[model samples]
Target: MKIRRWQFAAIILTIIWLFVRGVPLDPQVIFGELLLGFILAIFVTWGFRRMYEGQTNLSHGARVLPYALVYVGTFLRELIVGNVDVAYRVLWPSMPIEPVTVYMPLRVERPTAITTIANSISLTPGTLSMDYDDEANALYVHTINGRDPASIVAPIRRWEDLAIVIFGEEADPSDPAPDIQIGGDIDGE
Candidate 1:
């Protein structure tokens, strides 16, 4: 509900509107579009103002950009690596794959951070975030290979390290990650 929060949302929406509309040829038209886009964006942001209310640290906000950039880089790297691994398995029928569910307990308990982590896991290849245990604050992740749990977990933990700072989460990266429980039907049953 804060003006500052609404302002940021409106500014981002205006940028998106511009991208979707594309730049006009004439100078006057370009200026007109920008002005209209911003006006509409402001109104739209105001309409959804309630959704912006959540735990936010203005101090952490300033530091978040750098960490966010790093997290994106890590995510992309993992995405590419996952794609290659899945592709390899697809090409080679003889490749051994042990499918299992991993219980990944998160250090960050905030809703936004938890959702981000869950979506990121689901987005990556060969891994899916199946369910969330609210009481344990843990996620059940299904991966193509569980024989080397470290390989599957390493990237996720790296993401968490950056996410902690990016989302202004209270969890510390130095805190030990809980031992992940791995078990599932080994066969494709």
Candidate 2:
């Protein structure tokens, strides 16, 4: 009777994909695209069913739009800043690059949130997410400039803060922010 969250997500994603693919707005073309989208939505929903299980219901209700907008805006800004920083380091040979591996603790408990944050980090230009330790809830990140572990993790913490709200994760007031441990210089210095 009622469509599940995964099914809804699949349907929306399919429609977006079709639109991006330049499906025309003519009645006949629209009908055909809708039919195709319906078929693909079914398969996509089935394939990703497990992933939706146990996920936070944050995306289901009224707060979804605002949270999505905030997350997207913050991510875009960070992505741009990271790109420019990397570009500057590359273009200016005199720029000091203190590459270091940082162990960043995780506050979000949801698997989806954790994975999203990790992927976001890797997507940024100056940082690479090397690995995640589930047991420790820590992420190993390598950054071009990591002289101050806190500075390196500050943006990630901001991302995590937004993700907590977007993903409906409970923030623990008593739990201190994750500590960043610099492992060593990337150049073997």
Candidate 3:
């Protein structure tokens, strides 16, 4: 596997850190770790972007920092709130469970961004992305308690706007449409 510069640099820096910390490092083990790290990095990059041709730009990489911070902030807050919400539902005799599946229409065009949003929603508590229908241009997500399908789209779309800024900019939401089709299922699985 071809080694990217950052992957090599990360390996080198990690080795140096271990040395500075007085951790024993065998030559064979270090070589193996370097190879493994490089391979994993390549795979991760490919999964993130099918069109990414390994053009490593340090500047572009830095853009992820702000996006990551925002995502983490939102994730943590939602996680805590979700936990409490679940706890309340469990403890209450009412057992407030809507268990609804929403078919959300997507406005984003990039597959990577759309997938990111889908994955994020799935990862968050109380919701799961079931499927996608490219022909219908929509996403089917199962939510623990939702009043309507639009509820899923609103929050995800907001985060998607932030994600667009984090990863790459696209056409305005108000721009004329090309009738891209999509649809999906909401089984929370």
Candidate 4:
């Protein structure tokens, strides 16, 4: 209470609230929306702050902005590319489709980081997040064409790196990613 964690939360939450409101181009409208978000975020952060207790640093939200933005851009690019690749495979018929599942160990131990990475995998075409082994902090990802596990895991590792920063997880992004294991069964193949 003395450090006013709520102030930091309010600032970060206000930015998120404004974003969720679809930032308008008009100056007056933008100011109005920001004012409303500021008020709401204060209540929300203060009211719900009990859930955020025990975190090592509650003030890292602003520092996370750049990494979060980069993660979004990277995810978006992979989404578009995956969609095109999947569409081409669907249309061409002869395109290679060697489905395979891989187990990827993660440096990010937090649920938020793991879930973000898992969801990103599922959202991208030709890949699905079948399961997560929480004990190991790893994901089971199935890719349509995974002859090369490295290729399938490259973007995911990128996202994980960003998520570690965004979530303020204990892991260091500079640390090498764990070795991936080819795993699971895709139609018994």
Candidate 5:
């Protein structure tokens, strides 16, 4: 039987993950460890294929490598900025916490992409992904400073744009701007 594209991708990813996890390639390495890695790779690949269903076309050749690098760099930058922002709020005597929940409609349709975006939002400081309205295709995010919804959403939109390309999802030209609704303040009545 021939290996599918996703399977190949999975194998590559698995090998990379193993290397990153510090699995040595020395000849003295145990055979069992290698066997385990292969098994784990197969399992992960199978699960990915099942989860993505018809959306596992990550065979974009070398084009995807740069996008992947960009995504990681962008994510790291956001993470650092978020940490610093949260640290400032924590250290400041007068905590300026004007919390508000905003409903931002989803543009990326792929489940993995949507999940990644949600996780990224939650990972960022001052923002918490509370709920995902699948029916409405929206995400409810609670932010420490929501006075400017556009500003809050701008970065997320940037991430989404990158994710669209990274995940190989088609960008719908007709797609309207995300419907952002400023929910009531989360501080108090």
Candidate 6:
């Protein structure tokens, strides 16, 4: 296995921490600690890239940094707005909720990009990413007031495209769908 720089650092740090803790350095303990440190280093590496499916060796320079910043900014804004909206709806019972499920087709091909879109939708108010059918490559999202699933697709695809810019690689968004439906209503819910 090719050891990443960070993984090596993690292993060293773990060993140092264990040594500083004054644990008795028996042969068994030393072997166990080495094994534990190795495992922890691997775990850290995996966790850092949990979103990605395959090995990601992209240069983290101008190409990815700006888009990542944008993604964070947009996500924070949406999260705050969604929190306020959900709170307001909870406080004011007059808010109308048209519960509906939309079969939202995604253009992002990379697993990480797709996951980010799904997570962002679920995080925002009034929407939940119910499931992703890998067989059909589509998402089932439930929304509080969904009037047009097609319209929502545009915004979601936009977000995914930006995510691709940050994470690298995505399917083209120009592909067309027959129709987007919500709650078995052609008009949407």
TM-score of every model? 0.82, 0.79, 0.61, 0.76, 0.74, 0.64
Tell me which of candidates 3 and 4 scores higher on lDDT: 4
lDDT of 2 by residue, 9-86 (tens): 777877886877698778898888888888888798789888666433433545657866877788899899999998
Model 4, CA-based lDDT: 0.85
Over 4 Å off in model 3, which ranges? 1-53, 148-152, 172-189
> Model 3, 41-120: lDDT tens per residue?
55654465544445455576576778768866776766676677778888895976777767666666678777877888
lDDT of 1 at 120: 88
Q: Every model's Cα RMSD, please?
A: 4.0, 4.0, 7.8, 3.7, 4.5, 8.5
What's model 1's overall lDDT? Answer: 0.83
How well is each residue in 65-179 modelled by candidate 5, as lDDT tens digits?
7866877788788889879878998999497878888888878988889999899899988898999898888888988886677877877887787778777788752456666
> What's the lDDT for residue 126 in model 5?
84
Model 5 lDDT at residue 66 = 83
Q: Best-fitting candidate, measured by TM-score?
A: 1
Give stretches of model 1 more than 4 Å off: 1-3, 18-37, 54-59, 184-189
Q: Is candidate 1 or candidate 2 better by TM-score?
A: 1
Residue 96, model 4: lDDT of: 97
Instruction: Look at candidate 4 and give me any clashing residue pairs.
Output: none
What's model 3's overall lDDT?
A: 0.64
Evaluated at residue 104, the lDDT of candidate 1 is 85
- Clash-forming residue pairs, model 6: none
Model 4, range 65-93, lDDT digits (tens) per residue? 78989999999999999999999999999
Task: Kindly indicate the candidate among 1 and 6 with the higher lDDT.
Answer: 1
Cα lDDT for residue 114, candidate 1: 85
- Candidate with best lDDT: 4
Query: What lDDT score belongs to each candidate, Candidate 1 first?
Result: 0.83, 0.80, 0.64, 0.85, 0.76, 0.69
The TM-score between candidate 6 and the true structure equals: 0.64
Local lDDT at 158 for model 2: 81
